[model samples]
Target: MNPALPLARLGRATLDALAAIGQVTLFALSALSHLVRPPFYLREFGQQVMQVGWFSLPVVGMTALFTGGALALQIYAGGARFNAEAVVPQIVAIGMARELGPVMAGLMVAARVASSIAAELGTMKVTEQIDALTTLSTHPVKYLAVPRLLAATLAMPVLVAVADAIGIMGGWLVGTTRLGFNSAAYLKNTTDFLQAWDIGSGLVKGAVFGFIVALMGCWFGMNSARGAQGVGRATKGAVVAASVLILAANYVLTELFFSA
Candidate 1:
């Protein structure tokens, strides 16, 4: 049990963590810089838009719908303790629009799209495809990372908007049928209490989360170790990192948007 050995291991871990962070930051900046330059790949971008955005609708919608319904039940139960059950509609709308909708949609996309991107790119890397692209004078970041990044960033807000609607609808269904509330009144309260900013803030969060998801996926994939195990690990790491970052970023964004 030598103190020097323990200290040495801790120092190495800290250095490794810092190094990883620096690498990811540089990678993100490089991708963003390339985004504004020439040779825009419309075909690749369109394919990514379909893959990262359109294909993600089902999972996002389902997640939001279930979350909204569960949230309504939970809020209703808690409000009942204080005879504040009528606050359900307002709470549900705000919660969904300002937080749950975007967060859930982001996490789902991370789970689905992030892993797919990581696996695709990781396989490409291990098979020397990325190197081949470089040999052909193709920039990997510009060709691979930029399109997915742009597609996710652009499409996430739309997905969150749709999720917000579906989520609110889920709350309405629960409030009306399960909670003994009137359908018209539930919808009215939801609309009346929700403001434009609530929706806007959530959409902004969607964009940020989308960027994080794609960036993490691409970063991990591009840096993945050789072999099947490495690709698997990269895919797993992308999902976990994206999900954690989404939650952390959500808290920060919430404070920025709503804190007094």
Candidate 2:
């Protein structure tokens, strides 16, 4: 009955989505452009480094530890059916490095940092502090997004490294204790299976995911609507979008790196 109207609305929705993506991309480029300019904000960069990297350590460590432990148990149990129990160490190492480590760390940072970015910038926007910066001839992109983006991009690789190490340790503990694996043998199996490429790919994933997460946060934050409700919306939207993007990106990266 309303075929024409529905088709028109569908076209508008597609256009709106495209526009949103374009806005976010433009905003990210603007921030990167500022990063190359003069009068660098070393203090802000240092502060964001602490916030994104140092402050994130505890959560990333614990997540990696528990995930690795669980992976060991699951692999051992699955392998018992075929008398392939010794595969636990290798599987755990590969899984954590190639898949879980970067994805989990990215999602966690998205939850933590994305929300904070949205709230902080949204508040500034609501209170006109952003406008004040504009009036003062200062670029907010430089002042806000550059530091956060650089911090996330640099910090995520470090965080993933810590996660990978701790995750392997967790698996080692579980393999030795619950799975009745000899510690030296377990370590050997892990080392024998994991190549440089596996770990390197994970670190690369970390950097890319970090950029996406921080970019989404800054984009949503800068474009967030006025007032508390708008800020809340931005926060929720950023986290949801970042998490989804991380998983989608992980799959793509995996295919690029490993698929024949």
Candidate 3:
């Protein structure tokens, strides 16, 4: 390999990445600023709540249910090695509420809502609809991005709460039916072990993850290249970026909330 060529390529890649980061940061700040100074679009916000939140419930619920069930089985099997199988309820409750529930809901919403937003906006951009909005004196970021961002952030905590309940119920179903535990006992153990912080922390994580998801979608879509292929790429990139960011943010939030 030629040393000069490789060095040039590395430098180019670094610059491109930095440029992308700068662009995204500016876009995020713009959206945030639009969020407070309104011309508040309550109708758009309500539509997004339905699109992003209400439509997302089934997938989130199914994911939480299966994950909770599988987690129960895994934890039970693992705990049996140390004669601590009885810890299942408490562990499941904490595990789901503190981590899995928010994470799963966030990822699921990213997959669904992020892709939809990216595809829609990317299509609008390529079709010159965004320009039309601008020509009509509508700020694209305020008209398109801010409402979605606010809706997602507000709705995600509710989604996470539902996910938490469904997940714990899943573990309860497994514990009572498969693991030969009493229903009342399992419920009691779950409630007894859970504190306000565990659930609250997850909800907080949900809000952050939701913001990341919508932000990534809007940012990528706004910057998408022209044509169908560009729109497809933008949609895919939005989901991938949102998911990675969600997981990364989750770890950071977890450390802040739990690492005493």
Candidate 4:
């Protein structure tokens, strides 16, 4: 008897998804256009840079450190079976610099910053504060989205850089104390094996991931539906979308950088 209800719900869900996608596209174009124009919001950008990059340092650092420490232990353990334990330093450096460092940092920032941005903008939309900004002749895209995109894109590499350093330190601690690695010898092995390009490529990947995170957050928020339900939906959607995109982009970048 209620078969029609489920069909109607399916139709409504399809429409909502289409509407959200359209809104996200328009927001991206508007933000892109505004990015090139004047009336730059350095103040806003600085705040976002601090929020997305600086404020995220502790989480990012801790993530990297734990990952590096675990990686060192695992690598050493695995290598020991084959009498290949000497590969630990090289593997650690390569693994962190190539993949884990940027990807983990990106995910952390996406979780922390993306959801917050979506909630903030969704709140503004619901309260008509966005309209107020428009009434005051302020382009919300320029003032909000562009700054966030720039901040995340520019700051992610720096975060990854710090993460890389901290990660290496964690490996150093594990290698020297637990793994019976000579401190000086481990240091020399790591430094000698790592190339500058390995680190640089990871930072580049981080920047791209950062852009995706901010873009998804701003897109979802700017296009958020009305009411409390809409805000909650948008916030959750933004985080999920950003996380997926980060992992997807990481894979693409890895292929591009490493494939012959």
lDDT of 2 by residue, 42-95 (tens): 999899889888998899899999999999999988999999887999999999
Worst 10 residues of 1 by lDDT: 183-192
- Order of quality (lDDT): 1, 3, 4, 2
lDDT of 4 by residue, 1-260 (tens): 69899899999999988987787778778888999999999999999999998899999999999999999999999999999998888899988998989998999998999999999999999999999999999998899899999999999999999888888888889999999999889889999999999999999999999988999888888878999999999899889999998999998998999899
Q: Candidate 1, overall lDDT?
A: 0.96
**lDDT score, candidate 2, position 201:** 96
Each prediction's total of clashing residue pairs, residues at least 3 apart in sequence or on different chains, is: 0, 0, 0, 0
| Structure candidate 3, residue pairs in collision | none
Give all candidates' CA lDDT scores: 0.96, 0.90, 0.94, 0.92
Candidate 4: clashing residue pairs, number: 0
- Give the 10-residue window scoring lowest on summed lDDT in candidate 2: 117-126
* Candidates 2 and 3, the one with greater TM-score: 3
lDDT of 3 at 63: 94
Quick one: best lDDT, which candidate? 1
For candidate 4, the TM-score is 0.92
Q: Per-residue alpha-carbon lDDT of model 1 for 155-206, expressed as tens digits? A: 9999999999999989988999999999998988998999999999999999
Query: Clashing residue pairs in candidate 2, if any?
Result: none
